[model samples]
Target: MLSRTYSRRVDRVQAAVDALELPPAVYRTCPFEPRELVETGLRQWLRCCGAAMLDRQVIGMPSFAVDEAWHGLILCTERYAAFCRRAYGRFLHHHPQGGELAGSARRAGSMAEQLRRTAVAWSFVARPGEECVLWDLDVRVGVPEPWGAGTRP
Candidate 1:
């Protein structure tokens, strides 16, 4: 899942910022099928979120993940879904699974947490080098038959 936010500087004589909450992770609703997790899909998802932050494309309706961190998603004036595809694709190339998130979690020589729930969102803060701090958004999966928690993260 991812959280997309934008602060626009509006000024006639001053500046202001606007923040919008995005949807849960793109793959949150997709079932993991209890296979100890897969590599390709999750890694691709993370890469997309990171790219969205770097690209500055995320907007309203950021997605989320199990841990409640916000993954950055880009917003395109053209359409939101289109943006998702672009971001996801970029992630696939940057951090291929079975090589990173999926493969490394089981080993000690690696980094990157293995995520359980997919609901997610994101945001970014400036830092040195080409890397911005990566975030995984938080999303809620409604209770199976009826009620669930209404707490805010």
Candidate 2:
């Protein structure tokens, strides 16, 4: 099973991205599963088959790029994303507690390196050609109430 605390981390990260309000032009989504990250392989594979998407050739030809608004949203939070997606499957929730952690720290390390290098794409999806910032929940929840209800409790 997965630990509730570990799962909570993913939820928190997701909420932050939802709040960032990124511009529409800079991000997008690709029509492929995270597991199907064969960007270069797919291109080469297609050439061998002598097929294309214009005529509905392959069973799953990429119709769009992950650079799209919604896709970018998902791509932007790639840090906890792989874990989150696998955890939620159909929806977002805390992970069950039991299964041992998989994946390597090297991936997380790479993401950290990218984050230090950039603040926008800086957070997740290091391989991304383009990226934007996801909000920081730690700061979000601290924001004061509306002007009408101003003043600390």
Candidate 3:
């Protein structure tokens, strides 16, 4: 069973999805089982939410991390949302565990002070699914190296 916080987050994400005004058919074909779909969606949703809180801009054109990092220093909610939707459509492609994704977001949020001082920001990109990457102002530092390779998620 999902925790209360997780469940609430899921509800919010679902609400956001509904607000997108997309047809039901878009969500109906999720490749995962119903339960798994919800789990994956929750993670992707949180990732999107996290990215939305950062300073970045959404781009209509998709590009590699290197290019994206150089394009802007601000985060983009539109890009994040579209990425989440695409990840859901792809059945969570390279989905990480829901707990890990959520926890990472929480950790990132808690590091506001560090981020401001280090000239760093975190964001999520679809890459066809959710992937967490760190940016040093305008340079792609790299993905949160396995969550503990000399850095916290």
Candidate 4:
């Protein structure tokens, strides 16, 4: 069973991340349409990432829009760092595959494997009856090369 304190903490962190105002330029870089949907998905993804940090899990990003939003957040170094401390008691680092840290334990696997892990992570953090739209967010938003069609992450 989960304690109220834990639940409240999750809620508080989710609310804080959702309230974050990402740079306007981020929407331009995202390869998705309907800014509203992208923003909504991005916030949910960010909240999940924050919650996943509690268990030190390496949750892969499945949506380009969400990834773009994350990039924007990281650009605001001060705010992103402080948000991490408040939400997860530490800084959430981004270790993209093929980067200098490619061999690091934090580096994610192939897209298929990464998406699988993302789905599993979502299972742990999602609220009851909450449907995850991240897997097919690209398709739903009409991205040219959608990553997955009916997948859930």
Candidate 5:
């Protein structure tokens, strides 16, 4: 079972993912499953999602882990990144401290770097025999836009 705080984080991430309207894709490679099987499974999943699925080519590798119960997924998109920035700014507003904006700027830079590195990355928790729960979902915007660059609105 996930802690309350973790659960809240998952809820927030899920809300963000939902807002993106990118069809969900489950990527997992079991120890017992062959690579071919994993690929086939992912393809099948995407097919099931139909038009809702984001272009596989654009999404790149959907699975970020193998044999691990927990996983992390980072969806990189300009809109999503803006959403994260707004969300983070709101968070900072509610909980403020000196030099917080500087720290946030540094983190934003790091996030941008990661976004440039991958189309989508995954970071979540999935315990065996239980549903996978998101612990941290990082959004990397492809191109840095001027909108939502500063503090919260």
Candidate 6:
């Protein structure tokens, strides 16, 4: 069952994501078709992150397009910081794939393992009728060369 706080944070995160406008340059860098679907996927992932904030879990990015969308959001420092405060009460840090801390236990997982955790986090926070496309968002959105190959749905 979802705690009231977690539910509220998820709602706020979704709203923040909805309000964001990813610039065209972002798409130019990580091209994908059916922009709406990719955007929706990104929103859902962020909501999952918000929900999992207290758990201190690592939610991996399973799609190149969604990752790009996140990159765009992060570039908007003020808006992203404000949105993070509203959604999770703290800034959600992004650790690039190869930049894990030297001995940090939290960063000690393979990409596949991280993606599996992401799926599990989504299971806990997904809305009643919500369906996650993140597992295969790259291929679904026709990313030229999808990033995630071993991700489990």
The lDDT values for all models are 0.28, 0.29, 0.33, 0.71, 0.28, 0.76
CA displacement after TM-score superposition, residue 74 of candidate 5 (Å): 9.8
Cα error, candidate 4, residue 11 (Å): 2.6
The clash count for each model shown is 49, 17, 5, 0, 9, 0
Candidate 4 lDDT, 50-150, residue by residue in tens: 65665556676777666776787687789888878776677888876665364664455466666677776666568788777787788888877665565
Q: RMSD for all candidates, in order, please.
A: 13.6, 19.6, 14.8, 2.8, 16.2, 2.3
Where does candidate 4 clash, by residue pair? none
Q: Estimate each model's TM-score.
A: 0.21, 0.22, 0.21, 0.79, 0.25, 0.83
Question: On a 0 to 1 TM-score scale, where does candidate 3 land against the true structure?
Answer: 0.21
lDDT value for model 4: 0.71
Supply the TM-score for candidate 6: 0.83
Q: Kindly list the per-residue Cα lDDT of model 1 for residues 75-131, writing each as its tens digit.
A: 222333443344332221223234446544344232222221112222232222532
Q: What is the lDDT of residue 53 in candidate 1?
A: 41
Please provide the root mean square deviation of candidate 1 (C-alpha atoms, Å).
13.6
Ranking 4 against 5 by TM-score, winner: 4
Per-residue lDDT of candidate 5, residues 1-153 (tens digit): 547764555445444434543222222312323433433323322222221121121112223221111121122244434544432222111112233455554443443343232222222322235321111111121112221123111
Question: What is the model-wide C-alpha lDDT for candidate 6?
Answer: 0.76
Q: Per-residue lDDT for 1-153 in model 2, tens only? A: 436753454444444433434343223333333322323322222221121111112221111232122344444465335433443332222111232146433323342333232232122222336322122211222223211111111
Model 2 regions lying over 4 Å from their true place: 27-64, 67-153
Candidate 2 TM-score to native: 0.22
Instruction: Please state the error at residue 74 of candidate 4 in Å.
Output: 1.9
Error of 4 at 116 (Å): 2.9
